[model samples]
Target: MWIWFHKLGSPPHFYRTAGRLVPWFGIPALLLLVAGTVGGLAIAPPDYQQGDGFRIIYVHVPSAYISMFGYVAMAVAAAVGLIWRMKVAFAFAAACAPVGAAFTFLALATGSIWGKPMWGVWWDWDGRMTSVLVLFFLYVGVMALRSAFDDASKGDRAAALLAIVGVVNIPIIKFSVDWWNTLHQPATIAKLSAPSITMDMLVWLLAMVVGYTLFFAAVVTMRLRGEVLLRERGARWIRELNAHA
Candidate 1:
């Protein structure tokens, strides 16, 4: 396990491996996304309460879930980089920031759209909503901090420390609904018992969640490959790679 981990830390190995693995995750993510979208929007029966407006949950819920997942991933990668001084881990953490931010933005936007109809407001200062917004800023802050320094190593360390610190917000975002009275609905899928949703809706929702997770993997791998090339530009293997390309 340690040998394989070290091998993966090598830029050339990771680059070649990521190129080979992209299709495996990317193809399934696309298929599952299509299946989930169709199943949620067209096949699943309407919510007894919100009707078709609730259809947006297919996109909103997955986006929100992924946003939090991305932050956790970023924090873990940052921690790995900081503790082990692994260049690959730093590259991966840097790659996660933008993707996580995009997902967070999507979540907020979709949530607002969903809220406009359900809550009769386009925006609110509710705990969950506010916490998620703060999460978005945290992603931005990490990215900004990383780019702030003239020295790349200093920037990476700064960003990594911030990522580790900012992880506290993730749980707050997750439990905000439960901890406080808020406009946002409590979790339907993430529960100790069976989810409150029906099997039909549940199936598609779960698929979307899986699809989003896979998509994140695909995107991160692609980005990590590029990051490896940039970081390894001075190495001979990169010259060979460029020649091969």
Candidate 2:
């Protein structure tokens, strides 16, 4: 296990391996996304209360879930990089920032669209909403901080530290709905017992979540490969690979 972990940290190995693995994640993600969209929008019965407006959950919930997932993943990678001094891990954390930001934006945008009909307002200063906006800004801040320093190592460490420090927001984002009176609905899928949602809707929602995760993996892997090449440009193996290309 240690050997494989070290191998994954190696630039050439990770680049080659990620290239080969992209299709595995990408194809399944696309298929599941299509399936989930069709199932949620077309097959699943309308919410007895919200009707078709609730169908936005197919996009909103997954994006919001993934926004948090991306932050956790970024923080973990940042921690690993800081502790182990692994360039690959730093690259991964950097790559995750933009993707996570995009998902956060999607979540906020969809939530606003869903909110207009439900809450009769497009924007609110509620806890859940405000925390997520902060999370999005965190992603942007990390990326900006990373590019602020001329020294690459300093930039990586700064960004990593920021990511680790900012992780506290994640739990706050998760429990904000419960901790305070908010417009956002409480979680229906993540529960100790049976989910509040029906099986049909649950199935599609779960599929979208999985699909979004896999899609994130596919994109991050692709970005990591590019990052590896950029960072390793002066290395002999990268030169050889580039020469061949």
Candidate 3:
């Protein structure tokens, strides 16, 4: 297991393996996104209370879910890099930042769009909303801290530390509504035995969530390829690969 882990942490190996894996993730992502979109927007019945506006959940919920997933992925990779001195792990963490930030932004935007009609306000400092906003800032902070350093090693260490520390917010974001009296509703599908949502809605929501995850995987894996190249630009393998090109 450790042998495979070591090999995976190698820049050349990750670049080659991840390149081949992109289509696997991307193809499924495209199919699921298409199916989820159609099912949620056209096939599913309108919400009993919110009516058609709830359709935005098809986009908003998935984006919000994926944003948290990306943060956790980045933090774990950063920790691996810090513990084992794995350059590829550090590159993977850096690659996750932008993709996570973009999805966080999308989640916030869609949430606001959904909120205007439902809550009678464009924005509110609800616990979940506030915490998610904080999450977005954390993502930005990690990226900014990384680039702030002129030395690559210094940048990686700084970014890794921040990523690890920021993980505390993940739990805060998850349980924010339960922890506070907020206008934002509690999760609908959290109750496994008796979910508040119907199968028609639940199925598509899960599909969208899975699709978003695969989409993130596809983007981050591609981004990691560039990151690995940048981190290993002077390596013999990179030199030989470029020569062949």
Candidate 4:
């Protein structure tokens, strides 16, 4: 494990490995997303309560799921970089921020749209929703702090620290709907008992989740590739990469 971790920290090794995995992630991501969309929007039946408006779940739930997943991925990468002093982990943490933020943004947007019809309001001070908003802001903050530093290494370290600190909020966000009397619904898909949803709805939701996971992998690969180029600007690998480009 240590050997693999160290190897991943090496720029060339990561570049080569990511190049290989991109296609693996990319192909499945595209296929799953198409399947999820078609199944969710067309095949899944409308909610008995919310009617057709509930169909937004295809977009909303998947985006919300990915938003949290991305944050956790970024924070975990940052933790690895800080504890193990892995430069590639830092590169991955940096690479993951924008992608995570984009998912969070999608979640918020879809949530708001879902809310207007279901809850009769576009915005609310509910606990879970509010914390998720904070999570989004946290992503933005980390990205801004990264650019603010004149020293790149310092920036990486600082962002890593912030991410580690901010991770405490993830559980808070996850549990908020339960702990507080928030208007937002509690966990439906992650429950211990059989899902509260129909098989059709469940399948579509799972498909979307898989698709979003793939989309994240695809975007992160592209971003990581860019980060490698910037960090390895004067290295021989850069010349080789550029030649290939």
Best by lDDT: 2
TM-score of each: 0.98, 0.98, 0.98, 0.96
Per-residue CA lDDT of candidate 1, range 1-245, in tens?
A: 99999999988988899999989999999999999999999999999999998899999999999999999999999999999999999999999999999999999999999889899999999999999999999999999999999888789899999999999999899899899999888888797887898998889998999999999999998998887776777899988887898
Against the true structure, candidate 3 reaches a TM-score of 0.98
> Which segments of candidate 3 are over 4 A away from where they belong?
191-193
- Give per-residue CA lDDT, model 3, range 84-137, as digits (tens): 899999999999999999999999999999999999988999899999999999
Question: lDDT of each prediction vs. the true structure?
Answer: 0.93, 0.94, 0.93, 0.88
**Candidate 4 accuracy as TM-score:** 0.96
Model 4, 54: alpha-carbon shift in Å? 0.7
- Tell how far residue 166 is off in model 3, in angstroms: 0.7
TM-score of 2: 0.98
RMSD of each: 0.8, 0.8, 1.0, 1.3
Taking the candidates one at a time, how many backbone clashes does each contain? 0, 0, 0, 0
How far in Å is the alpha carbon of 132 misplaced in model 2?
Answer: 0.2
